[model samples]
Target: MASPQYRLVYWPGIPGRGEHIRLVFEETSTPYTDTATTSDGLDRVLAYVQGNVPDDNINPPPLAPPILQHLADPNNDTNVTTISQTSNILLYLATHLPPGSIAPDPKTDPNALFYLNSLALTALDGLSNEPHDCHHPIASGLYYEDQKPESLRKADNYVRVRLPKFLGYFERVLGSGASGGGKWLYGGKFSFADLVLFQCLDGVKFMFPKAVSKYEREGTYAKVFALYQAVSERPKITEYLKSSRRQKYSDGIYRYYEELDIEP
Candidate 1:
C-alpha cells in the first residue's frame, strides 16, 4: 500500500499562493491532488478545518490557499497535514526534493541561496503590502474606490521606489553568479530562490509593465528575466504551465488593475 497521497487546499479560483506549491510539485514530478476547484473541494478543505478531517492525526493550519497535506500515512485514514503561508510551503517542499534538488542544503552554507530566498520573500512581503494599500489604503476593511486617493499615493511610491529596489537586488544576484557567468539568480544550480524571484518578477511586470520595462533594461537585471524565460521553457514546466494549473494574471499577488497603472 502506498501513502495516502498529498493534497493541496486552496481557493479554486486564481493560482495565487497555491500555484507556487503546484509548480514545485510539477517540476519535481511529484503526485498530489488539488482539493479546491469546486464546492466539493471547498467542503473538503472546510471539513478539515472543522477537525472533521479523514486522518485524525493530520493537523490544520490557521490560514488557507496554500496548505499541503501529507497523505502517505499507512493509517489509511483521512487525517490531513495542512500548512499555510507560501514561503513555508515552498521551504517544506524544498527539503522533500532529493536534497539539493530544489534548494541548496543548509550544510553547503549556501549563502547565495539563503540570501536569494530572503530577498525573494522580502519582495513578496512588500508586494502584499502594496495590494492591501491599493484596496484599503487607509484601513483594511475600506473599499479601493473609497481610498482611491490614498491608494494612488501608496502605489506611486511603490512604483517609483519600492518596486525598483526589489527588482534591482535580484538583478544583481543573477549577475553575480560566476559559474554560468550570468544565468539563474544563484547561478549553476536552479534553487528555489530563482522560482520565487521569477514569480515576483512576473507579478510586477504584469501589474506594471512600463515600470518593469524601465528597470529590466537597466542591464543588471537582464539575467534574472532571462532565467525566468529559461525556467518556463523546461519540458515538464512547459507542460504544467500550459495546463489549467498555471494561474492567470487576473488572479494572485500580481493583479492587474488598469486604473492603478498611472504614468507620468
Candidate 2:
C-alpha cells in the first residue's frame, strides 16, 4: 500500500487534546502538517467544531481539535475522517500504520492494541476525574475563581483520595510489565496510549504539585516517565514540540491555575 498522506487540525494554544495525535504521528515518523498555527488557527478550529463536523455519522465525535484528515483516499479529494476521544485517535493510528511498525499484530499477538488502548483510556478517564475534582465548581465552562469554593472543596478531595487512585493504577500497570514484558504502558511498545498518559501525568503534576508529590511517595512510575522522555526526544516529536504549533501549557484545557495547587 502507498504511504498515507496526513494533515492534522487541532487547537492553536496548549498541547490539549491534539498533542496525543501529534505524538503518535511523530513516533511513526509519518509526515503530517499542523492545520492550526495561530490565534486564527483556533478560529478555524472553532468553525470545524461548530460547522464542518459531521453530525449524521453513527459515531459522531465528542469534541474538537486533533482531527486527522486522511489525505490518501482515492475516491475523494483529501477525504476527511475525524475521530475524537484522544484514546480512540491513538488506537486508530496504532493499528493503521504501515505494516511492521510499533503496533503489535492484532490477529496473532497475545495482547491486542485495542485492549491496551482500552486500559490506557481508563487511566485517562481517571486522570480527568482528578482534574475536574480539582476545579469543578458549578460547571466546567466557568473560571476557577467563579467556582472557588467548589474548586477548593474538590481540590481537597483530590489530594485526599483521587490522586493516589489514579497514580496507583499507573504504578501497578508499569510494574506488571504489560508493555510486551518491557517498560512503558502496553505491549512494551510506544503507542498513542503512552502519550495520553504522559500528557495526563504532566498536566496533573503541573496543576497539583503537592498532590502529585504525595502520590509520588508511593513511588514514581519511573519506567513510564523514562519512556515519556524517550518519546519526547524522537526527531519529529522533538521538532513539533519546539515548533510554533506547540502550545504553551497556559492556554486551553489543562491550565496551571495557582489555586488548583494544594498542600501535601
Candidate 3:
C-alpha cells in the first residue's frame, strides 16, 4: 500500500481526543500515519504544542495535540497546513477528502456541513467534555484523587441529568425528519456526524455502562442506540474496531471508575 498523504500528531499512550479524527480516517480507509506510534512522535507532537516547530510562518500555532498535517505537498511546510481541535480537524477532512469518505460533498450541500458540524460539536460538549469532568470535576490540571468529593457530585448530576438531556436531543434529531427519517444523522446519508456520535456513545457506554443500559432498556432513545449499532456494524468500522488502530479506552475522555459508577 502507498504511504498516507496525511500525518496525525497526538499523544501516544492514550487515545485522548485523537480517536475522533482516527475514526474518520478508519471509516474512509484514508491512509494516514499516527505520530503516536512513530519514533519521536511524542516529541514531534510537543513541538507543535510548544510552538517550537522551527517554522516562523505558522502564525498562531495550535495550542494542543491531535494536529493533522498535509504531507502530500512538500512545498508547504509540514506544519503550515496543520489543523488542531478534533471538530476542526474533522471539518477539514470532511471537506478536503474524496466525497463519501466521511460526509456528503460540501459543494452540493454546504449548509449540511455546518449542521453536521453543529451536531458533532454538541456531542463533544455533552458526551466528551462533561464525562471527562466527572472524574476531574474541580480542575483538569489536578488529579482526580485531589477532587474526589466534587467529582462524585458531578458524576451524579451527569449520569442522572445531563446524560439523558443529550441523548434525548439526539433521539429527537434522529426522529425529527431532518435526517430524512433514516438511520443517518443528515440527508438520509451516512456522514461524519454519525461517526462522531457513534464514538461519543461508545465512550459513554464504556464510562457509564449501567446508566446506558437503563436508558437502552427503557427504549426512549431507540434511534440513538440504533445509530450506535449501525455505525459499529459498518464493515470498515467493524474491521477497524478489531484492528490495532482502534485504541482501547483508558484514562482518556471516558474513564470508568467504580466510585463514579451510578444507577441511572
Candidate number with greatest lDDT:
3
Predicted candidate 1 versus true structure: per-residue lDDT over 102-170, tens digit per residue: 776767754645565575587567655465455467886665668887877877788887776766666
Give all TM-scores, in the order shown. Answer: 0.82, 0.82, 0.94
- Prediction 3 global C-alpha lDDT: 0.87
Give the higher-TM-score candidate: 2 or 3.
3
Q: Candidate 2's error at 136, in angstroms?
A: 3.3
User: How do the residues 1-264 of candidate 3 rate in per-residue lDDT, one tens digit apiece?
Assistant: 446678899988776789888888888888888986799988998888787876556545788888888765644444347788899999999888898667788778878889999999999999989999999888889998899999999999999999999999999999888899759898899998898899999999999999999999999999999999999999999999998877888877889899888996
Cα lDDT computed for each candidate against the true fold? 0.68, 0.68, 0.87
**What lDDT is reached at residue 213 by model 1?**
79
Error of 3 at 174 (Å): 0.1
Model 2 TM-score is: 0.82
Q: Candidate 2 at residue 264, lDDT?
A: 56
Query: Candidate 1, clashing residue pairs?
Result: 3-72, 4-71, 4-72, 5-71, 54-78, 54-79, 55-78, 55-79
Candidate 1, residue 262: Cα displacement in angstroms equals 2.7
The Cα RMSD in angstroms, rounded to one decimal, for candidate 2 relative to the true structure is: 3.5
